[model samples]
Target: MADEKIKKVSIICSKGSLEGVYPALIMANGARMEGIEANLFFTFFGLDAVTKKKVKKIKVATVGNPAMGIPTLIGAIPGMSAMATWMMNKKMDKLDIPPIDEFIEMINAAGGKLYACKASVDMFGLEKDDFMDEVKKILTVGEFYALAAGGHIIFT
Candidate 1:
């Protein structure tokens, strides 16, 4: 298996937080960079990463995130989420990590396919126009499975 090349990857993004969303984007971008076909499927809160109105505002979840190294009580304090988000954004910016919107554009430009979950879209009462132009289709789970056939499935 180690010798076999990956032909495709189907990445599922189910959370909207910056921490949740970036992993999927980074994986998809890296896959495309390696010449592997890539598909990003947004569902549940993950739809925020694709939604034009919410994409730019994705924030870190300071509360309940032990990785932040802060107490949950402190994380729950007012403005803590925003402060953590700002600090993280600054660090990422310094590392040259593109913003979420720009990262998605780069992935799309690199030939990675973007998809919205049909069930989630309906649940959220969102339409095609609500998503970025990069989203190629709103797909049912079965349809996404079809597209993912023969590829590795990654749920981030």
Candidate 2:
């Protein structure tokens, strides 16, 4: 009998805002739940998702998102971003979903890997000190591909 193989998964998150950030986290966490070895690599705007200072402060954009509908209009109104963010957070809370920061921590605790893109770090003028401690390393695209090569690679 052959031993079962565990799947390896790689997720690249390139967008910065709330809508962009959550999908990556949710997918990565879901992969972990399925017993896969999952790696989430943050590049460009997605870097905010792993930054210690910025992770907890991620907010939803109410304006210009077609999916947000009514909230989009509300977001277009003055002072609506704050309200939208609050309501979004409240909805997540009601569903027992932890904040993105806490969800990231849970994923880490489950042995998922987190990485930052070296190129993006330099482009954004961010030092290693700017990210959270959970980030395993800052890697080049080639290095990221080495890990992603055989696995299912997803870009969010």
Query: What residue pairs are clashing in model 2?
Result: none
lDDT of each: 0.96, 0.87
lDDT of 1 by residue, 4-80 (tens): 99999999999999999999999999999999999999999999999999998999998889888999999999999
Per-residue alpha-carbon lDDT of candidate 2 for residues 1-156, written as tens digits (9 for 90 to 100)? 258565888999998888788888888888898899899999998999889889977877777787777655566887677777888889888987778788878889988999999999999999888998888899999999998987889998
The candidate that wins on TM-score is 1
Off by over 4 Å in 2: 1-6, 71-74
- RMSD, one per candidate, in order: 0.8, 2.9
Scanning candidate 2 in windows of ten residues, the lowest lDDT window is: 66-75
Clash total of candidate 2: 0
